[model samples]
Target: MSEFVSQLSDSLYAVFQSETFVLLNTVDQESGGPTSSAISWVYAVDHSTLRLALDHRSRLVDNIKANPRVTVTVFGQDTIYAINGSATVTQDPLAEVPFKMCCFDVHIDAVRNALFYGAQLVAAPEYAKIYDKRAADKLDSQVFAAMKKA
Candidate 1:
């Protein structure tokens, strides 16, 4: 919807890949105060949406139900992509404890470039490889393992 959103798809993808953890910021359900959690269970559903698979025990799920407003901050190469969106939770059962999963359907509202020097930094030749490795080695490992079991 904004230049920040339109132009940053590739850049955001890179960040999403390399970053082992993204900061999920949400407000407290009752107090309406800010809270942030380092999460590794999120992925882009599309350009305008993201899906997060989180355990029901997290307060983040409750916060989303109370107020869908959320901001996901991804980082790498000293660059930050803070994606603003709303969330929709869906119940998904798991074999492990806490059998419920909150699959958040984030609707993109804005993109804030959290950067230094007023823009992005120069990327290295191995940046893409780094991205790929992080995606498979860290982020997707859980999902892949689950698929293998299935």
Candidate 2:
């Protein structure tokens, strides 16, 4: 079993500053079932808090609104980190973005090193944008810049 900490490590924070593959889990309000979504626009605001931007109409927003409890599984720095937290919708149609987006602020409760015992990850996950490269890059730039701003 792995131990749990109250905040993210320096390595985890750095990785989240850029595009990284992470899985967000939330509870379905009506069914009480777990819902998981792959996301990349995640940023660590600090050791104990994180910010995520998603489409305003995405189901994840609805789930989070219904239940704030969430778990974000971060895959980077040669290990997997399961970060449990409670999230609040900080912004809808976040300012400075061309399209409608929602921002979520997550207060971390616990962080666990979920990598299997005695094993190390050889590589982290990678992804390619399926849409127009120029458009995607522009959108990401705008979103991340807004996220970093105070």
RMSD, every candidate, angstroms: 6.3, 1.3
lDDT, candidate 2, at 61: 85
lDDT for each residue of candidate 1 in 1-150, tens digit (9 for 90 to 100): 224653237656555443356789999998889999977766665577766766778888889889999998777565667788888754344333234555677788888776655676565223233467765565356652332232
Clashing pairs in 1: none
Please provide TM-scores, in order, for all candidate models, with all chains considered together. Answer: 0.68, 0.93
**CA shift of 148, model 1, Å:** 13
* Candidate 2 residue lDDT tens string, 50-150: 99988877888888999999999988677888999999978876889988888999999999988989888888878899999999999889999987762
Candidate 2's C-alpha runs over 4 A off are: none
Sequence-dependent TM-score of model 2: 0.93
